[model samples]
Target chain A: MDSSPLVLTLASIILASTPLIIAVCGEILTERSGIVNLSLDGTMLMSAMTGFVVAFETDNVWLGFLGAMGVGAFFAFIVAFGSIRLRQSQFAIGFVLTLLGDDLSAFLGQNYTRIPGPVVQHYAIPILKDIPIIGPIFFNQNVIVYFAYILVFVTWFWLFRTQPGLRLRSAGDRPEAGFARGVGINFQRYLYTIIGGGLVGVAGASYSLNIKIGWAEGLTRGFGWIALAIVIFGGWSPIRGMFGALLFGATKALATYLQRTFPEVSVVAFNAIPWVLMILVLLLVGSDFTERVITVAPKSLRRPLQRFLKISPPQALGSTFVED
Target chain B: MNANRWIRWVWPAVPIAGALVVTSLLLFFFGAAPLEAFQAMYDGAFGDQAKTLSVLAFWVPLLLAGTGLLVTFKAGLWNIGIEGQIVMGAIAASWVALRMEAPSAVLITVEILAAMLAGALWAALSAVLKTRGNVHEIFSGLALNSIAIIFTNYLISGPWQPPEGGTFRGTAPFQPGALLPLYENSRFSPLSLLLAAIAFTLVVIALRGTFWGLKLKAIGQNLRSAFLLGVSSEREMILAMMLCGALAGLGGAVRTLSWFDSLRQSISGGIGFMALLVVMLANYRMFLVPPIALFFSAVLSGSITLQLRTQLHSSLGGILTELMVLFVLLFGDWKKLGVFRKKDDDG
Candidate 1:
């Protein structure tokens, strides 16, 4: 009946990583179809606050998540419409939305500050929870966490092994070619971006309802940019992004643990670890740098190492498609 | 032709008017009367001589940062990391204010230079990453910003914490000599104003008349051809970034040496970003930077009063800034944004 540190930390990591996992997976799917939704941070904040407010008022957590998704999708639709139909810069619009969304959330969320609301209840799968440490870490969590676990596999399977997934990848990679092959490139982009936004909304709802547990200004302050970075670090792959999300979650958990144990060390220093590491990784893992490194590497180690650090942005991302 | 020329000067105002209308709707929705909010906003911005000077004081950093942003925009770079550069500049100035001793004039000079150098160096790191490491400026800038904030937080709340135990208030107040000269009990410092105005004037001159400015234009137009023409692309890129960084640093220094006695985590106060919007609104014209900066500073000053007098949030300033940017993006000529060339339309 006693809480063990190891078990608790592991459980916390899973819970901590869930929101990020959902966010990264969402971003991966969106970027795979060649759209950059730079509004993850704002979307998450707005949705988290909305989710919390709605859940607090409705006495239902699922409604809050749904409301958050709707908010997320609405923002994504705006970005998609701007980029696809209006022929404006997606990057510019998304950047603007990040500021706009943050302000809107702060303005609207004035009444909801520090208000306690319903949180997602923990539910353990009976047979699975009885297993070793892995079971406890994986199965003994909320439904949102379980959904995040399922999302990684489902996203990977859909992106790599299905027909629509091929269309999606082609829409991002080479839109002209996909268009010639009868794919509605812009429509596909719109659909995927909104879908991605919806998942990002779920991530936001998960944060307020399950992980961090409240509405606050700057609740997900730095997390959105981290998710955006992870998408790049993961090289636009669902599985890699999922792993990157988990790695980031573990790093955060480790930082929190370190902050507690090493009281003398400034907490900000611990907080800076992930950002510094992300930048260093981003610089070192550029496609060109990786190419040169792999070319000069010893034969046996090169392939696996190359595979490990591989990251390539979607070729047609952030540019509007035009017929030649 | 004269009418057309006249309209060109008036076009930027349309967005401001449109944004005001949009903001009115938002205010009304939030239960504040549009007229009352506008009257309150105007009164807060320029109701008295004291208010006018305060607006001028706040405009200095935005002006400096906007001019810096104009430099980067000229080179077709987005120096979003200016926020970090601003913070780094403050840290450097504080380092001098606390650790070094000199005459008042000499001390302020060294502090300003150190701040600019620190900001330039921080920005230069992002430039190097982009030029040598193949990382985009946006990502590098975004990441660096978080890192710089953490670094500033560490200094302010940890090692550089005031001796009176720790709080998020900021470091111990700087010595009297470190603070900028204030004007007859007004918060405004005429010296800081002169410094900012002089820096912006030099930048405007350089942009209009210098060979380096022409080369930046050429490079921004077409990187490969400009490089083929012997315009050192990497060198120009780094120099442009550093100049902007230094400019943003100057903004930071003014804030440090003039307004506030101690450095805090919110020292930059998003002035770098606000300046970014100003730069875009100014259409890269250095002459327009001050007015735009003043308008923004007014919005900010007014928003503070709005918060005090009503249940409204201070984030209304951010909303208004976003509104202005959005309106401009939607209706203003895209060519004015500097990303599109008018010549291309002709061709």
Candidate 2:
């Protein structure tokens, strides 16, 4: 029931990060399946444009989401087919798709730029939103934000708790063994990649339809790469990735606050914080130096340090899959 | 063997045709005439002396960047940090032009050298991260790219603001001596183009005739095998990246000194990225780089007029090029086409 700047900023941070949370979750799933969908930046742009345009024309928001998801799934299918069936480099295919998606969005969305469109109505959960700081920040948001909250936990449960999740992990971590066990490796890759891409599409729709509220050239440029970085920073765990998104959101909020507070300062440089943080976080997690430092630490500190710092990727993240 | 000779020439056309078809369908979907758009683009690129000169000016930097990428690609490294290298090159040249006072020729030479050094050092950071820290070049390169852009923002807004005020547009124009000698009113500078041409020749020589080139190929093919054969893979990779960065930096120097009078925000303006696409479309063939880069430059340069004549987004240029590269990569394999062969040979 409060309108304090602190509460509002916190709420806004959560709202802004919803798209990233969904995207990181999707990319985490894809990479967990040993497929790196590097087309996230372009996929997000294309879907945002498609979501906005479809929603604008049909006057139905859900259809927009569906259309966006279809676009996402199609792009992912290409990646899966190229890497899995044709044995082409996933990075090469993904990079091209990213460019194609960007250019396509700009060209197609030309007629639709800056146009007002249907928006997702705000809804607050009566009971949960009544709580203190946490409720205002988490529960007092739109349906997509609510979905993002559930999605992270659901992703964690799906990856760790379910049998199918175990098979998915095996597909990415050890495809040969999985195939030997008759896991239908390529099929799982295609299925998960598409599903993950659909979620990414939902993230894009959330941006145009909910958070940012308009389509433009490069509607969500650079954030997709940030999500990719956060996935690594999260160690490919949905929960950790959620935290990474939140941290990025907080930095952005802080940058905006600083710019407003100190009118003379050029905080445009602050836009680079997420990227700089990306490198620093990856270095902390991915570098051998950190491992050595953890080794030299006190024995009691070593366990927690290793637990905190362990961020290895799936063993077969970018390689082609072959059926013998 | 005889079939292969003709196949190589024919193979290149398939992707080109596929690209045209896809772009045409896209234009038709949007209710635009595809042929009209293409004609507009062609005219824009070569409509007159100035337009063609502009295309050539754009081609110089693109050619330089693509030439550098050839070295990195040969070493099996994706030097995506090249965008940052180019930016860093511009900043270094700007720093020299802004602060140093010297003879015209000496200042130009020093500015270029500084730009090359700065670019190489920036690229070396990515190389070091890959080799020493085990961070992938893609991620590091992306991060470095952002950092370089941010650094430019800081310089422009804070320290390097023009004498009049802080517009965030760019620093003040350099002294006449600091700039490359332009050809009439055009952005094209014969010196810069000559430099690009020389860089291309040197790279071709290095890749074709030198032992270092063979070592790079070995490292690219199989890192473990190369190491087993007494080649230092890490050092070679670093050297390759630095060499690529140096050439890319030269491109940046050309961009700032000749293309524009001063260092502007987004100085390279996706030229570095376009070069990456150019090299990819060229299939990493050194010989294909120049013509392909020139084509890309013309397409992009012509897209300016495309936007005016068609009321379409200028990204049509990007769309066409990306589609071409994608189709080429997807269908380039002769066995996949099955045009000249009957059975699919499983690799």
Candidate 3:
């Protein structure tokens, strides 16, 4: 019952939630464009492995970040192509890509198990770092942690204020209206999904190079699912998504604290906390939240891009827009 | 109109044929001749008495799981948590088998019921979330899967730990009488096959002949229309999920009682996902379920043979199976291809 431990516990929760905040923010952008990339989990896992492996080999964390983003973009392209161009079900294609991504990552990462990754050094702002309890928890974090906050503000500004952001929102909200206005709805979806996926990939790389600093099989263990849930919890807005990530991160941090404090409680049972929380959140939010969040979502998302479905996703989310 | 009739029957058959050709090419990559691999696969799966029995041993659980998936798909609900349900079923059945020292007949009956109940209850949670909480069934089911795995791990590693200091991987072995009687002296068990066959037939009948089955199909095809017609969409969805869970649970039970003496980690071994693939490959057709299940069973059984004969990785089978699924999915939508289109004759 030491109050000191509780304070430490609160600090660690913010730290644990950083990667999730980064990932969910990226997913929020992706989903806003009307594409539910179920492959986020697999993409993150693969990127985590690739990023760590490259960093381990090159001893450059930047290379790890780049490698992770590259892999994420590549997988996103597959999903986009399969569902968008080929006119397959996004859910099915996304699910397949996820399975493929997971298997491929595991297969490729077989040799890199437990390999140490280059540690991402933390940078503390001089004045901010010295600001008591809030300073250490917020200001003193790895470069990615700072980037995550910046990205949230940047995303918020771009999504609500910029012309391109307005256009993207229009495409998500009502593609027909966007199409009538001569907006390139499909291109916008493709742009956002790939960008969002790349960000998610970076988050995965952060897990290995910054957070854990090592590779292992099934290393992600369902962080991707948590990120997916966070997107909904955030009500599909980038800024709110960050808060959702913090909530999940806090829960995870608390679970760790509990496991240590109450040794009698099984750690395996404790691990189920996030998933149980996800279900509860989904139940509590109801469709009203979904409707509100998806109000700004891309119009063509759940709809197939094909003529058969007639009410498909944007004409171009998954299709390759090759100029003839 | 004539073309429509032709394409309806022709479309489904096309993917199966395409799958075979692609699968042949994959076999060739492993340094085995395409024809020989086909022969071996067929022979290995059904060539001899012993092999056929082993195939049946694998087929029973797959068939049961696939039929369960078929039910959910018909209701427009994708219960991907079948793997989790299967594990819960196996755990429940094993719990009873380990605790009770009843007669073989009574033990078998009780185990099956326990497995079905466990599976149904597990699926019921997702159904409730979908109906009452308005949660998306897929995510809810996926989240439940992790929780189920954690619960299973807890049971095996904690309370269900065997008396001896054996490997902490699986539960304790079942008693001699607890096991299903084998088919004569062979490794194949008649009881599992009988259950699978009965389950498959029942599913087909339920889907095609029963009023409930028709309601599920209507709901699946168009929920709004079905609801307008006074169909209780929520109830139908829940019932479909429950039925799906029960079948998957039975698969788990059979696997435990007949094949493995104990419940191992990953006992379902991606079979639930494989069942999803089977349902997709079969176009959600009920009668086509068994053959497709058998085909997948052959691919899996052959991969093991290939591994033993050629020293390849056992996971090669999974890779190949995934490849087949990928190709089939892409091919199913081949109507979108420009080349496949008839030229428009503008006057």
Candidate 4:
């Protein structure tokens, strides 16, 4: 009933979603290059652990972020390397790496568990922080949150407005066509995959440094899969992925909020709300189901509804490009 | 012909040897003498009857999971939700084991069936989502795994907490009648081992020799062609997933009913993913699944001593297995990498 509680909740939602927004944006970029890196969960866990450990050691959160990005990019590079050079299944290698990375983080991070690390310092923008609801919601946050906000606009503009962005989209959609126009298809895939992976690392770092604020076993706890799902839900657009991330954050917040009132509901079961919602979202957005729904939908609603939910991934998303 | 035969035998061996060298390097990084850590691992696995039985006990769930994964891999379906399936099976079996008031034999039968049905139903949900709902199995599986884990955690820490109190340690030890009886007070029962061994043999026989197995493989390889050749692709896929789910379910049921006193929060304990590694390492060869599962279980059992004795994390065992698979991917297919070529399509 109170405005302050609503404002604080709104602010927390934005704060919590910063990492997911970064992760989904990274995945959008990677998938746009026609490579699907399914190692997000493991990558995030490993990088989060590494990031926290580095920050704890160095007494600098930025260094932690850098270390995480490097770790993430390295894992992503291997996927691209295996898929492009070794001619292995991207899904297989990525899957194995996810498991390996997760286990490895647990192994290597034994010493770092529960130890306090340097945290991302909050910075409230001077003039903007005073601007009523908007200022309290967005302006009064850490540098990472600000960076995430900026990243949304920057990536969206870069993807939709820039010439290279068009070429990147082209590479994913029809690499053969891109190749005909003199684009090096595989090279682009490798480049974007690594870049996206590094971004994913930063997202992981944000969890330890800014959001969750520490490392633990199973840190992130399969939340990376949520980011992956958000990418599809976002229709693979960086801006839309940010919205999806926010939506997921809102769901988590709602679960936490409702848990306060409904104490009888088991906390663990309530915590599963986001996942259940995601599965439902995927079911509803599914191609065949949507087509059926569109048929039943009134004529006026069908177009807008289809436009809202129809998600067509990059054409060469998983296929290994072999020159004929 | 002689050279070709030689390459077939030697090629696989080369990568394993390469993996040994790489793993030794990793051990050195872990600050344990490579030879010392490996020796400890060997001693731990075959140290005594107790240790060896422990390894076999570990192998039971692994082989159960691997056999089910075998079918899915052959069917060209990735049942990544085996982890959740395993958990679901345990949940169902636990539900019966704790609540049922029946004769021991009847209880055991119902427990096993419940676990299998629970696992099958969970997997079928994913399959239904895949076939009818247009959701990819991977996504649905991933989501379900989290949901299942949270649900299990709730049951353990919420409603089903032992009379003592609610805690994450899992439910208090099940009644003796609900558990699989131990043989001579060993960590596991002989009957459990026999069951896994029998299941493994049957799965191998069915996958290699049966027409049903061939059809699953056919559907996996080319669904359109298989359908054209009079295969029921959709129904068969669901059945394949269910069979795999049932196997994983049995893994859970065995672990609950016999293997352990009670379910831990990490009841599945990453065995689902490990089984995937095993099946992949075996190159989808059902017969190879047992040895590979055994090898992994040995590595896991052995690594416990590595942790206690050498101060290395037990996860080194998992890391070592992963490295071997990576090496196999690299060096097993060195010829494909054009390190050397036979100039023939046979390889």
Model 3 score (lDDT):
0.77
Candidate no. 4 TM-score: 0.94
Tell me the tens digit of each residue's lDDT in model 3 across B237-284.
988999989988998888888878787766787788788878876767
Better of 3 and 4 by DockQ: 4
Give the better candidate number (1 or 2) by DockQ. Answer: 2
Top candidate (DockQ):
2
Error of 1 at A73 (Å): 1.6
CAPRI-style grade of the A/B interface in model 4: medium
In candidate 1, which residue pairs get closer than 3 Å at backbone N, Cα or C atoms, i.e. clash? none
Model 4 backbone overlap count: 1
10 residues in a row with least lDDT, candidate 3 chain A: A304-313
lDDT of 2 by residue, B241-328 (tens): 9999998898889999999989898898788788888888888889999999999999988889988998877899999999998888
Candidate 1 regions exceeding 4 Å error are A1-3, A260-264, A287-289, A298-303, B1-18, B218-225, B283-286, B333-347
Which whole-number lDDT from 0 to 100 does residue B236 have in model 2?
Answer: 95
The TM-score leader among the candidates is 2
User: TM-score of the B chain in model 3?
Assistant: 0.89
- lDDT of candidate 2 over A1-324, digit per residue (tens): 766889989899999999999999999889999899988988999999999999999988899999998888888888887778666778888888888999999999998999999988899999899888877877899999998999999999999999889889888999998889888888889988998888889899889999889898899988788888899999999999999999999988887777888888667766777777778788888888988999999999999988788877889887767786
True contacts kept of 2: 0.69
For candidate 1, lDDT tens digit of each residue in A1-324?
A: 224788778788878988888999998889899899988988898899889989999989999999999999988887887677666666666777787778888888888898888999999898888777777778888899889889988999989999999899899999999999988888889999999999999999899999889898878877888899888888887788877887887887888889999988877899887877787878877737778888889999888987887666779887788644
Which residue runs does candidate 2 get wrong by more than 4 Å? A260-266, A298-304, B1-9, B337-347
| Candidates 1 and 2 compared by TM-score, better number | 2
What lDDT score is found at residue B303 in candidate 1? 81
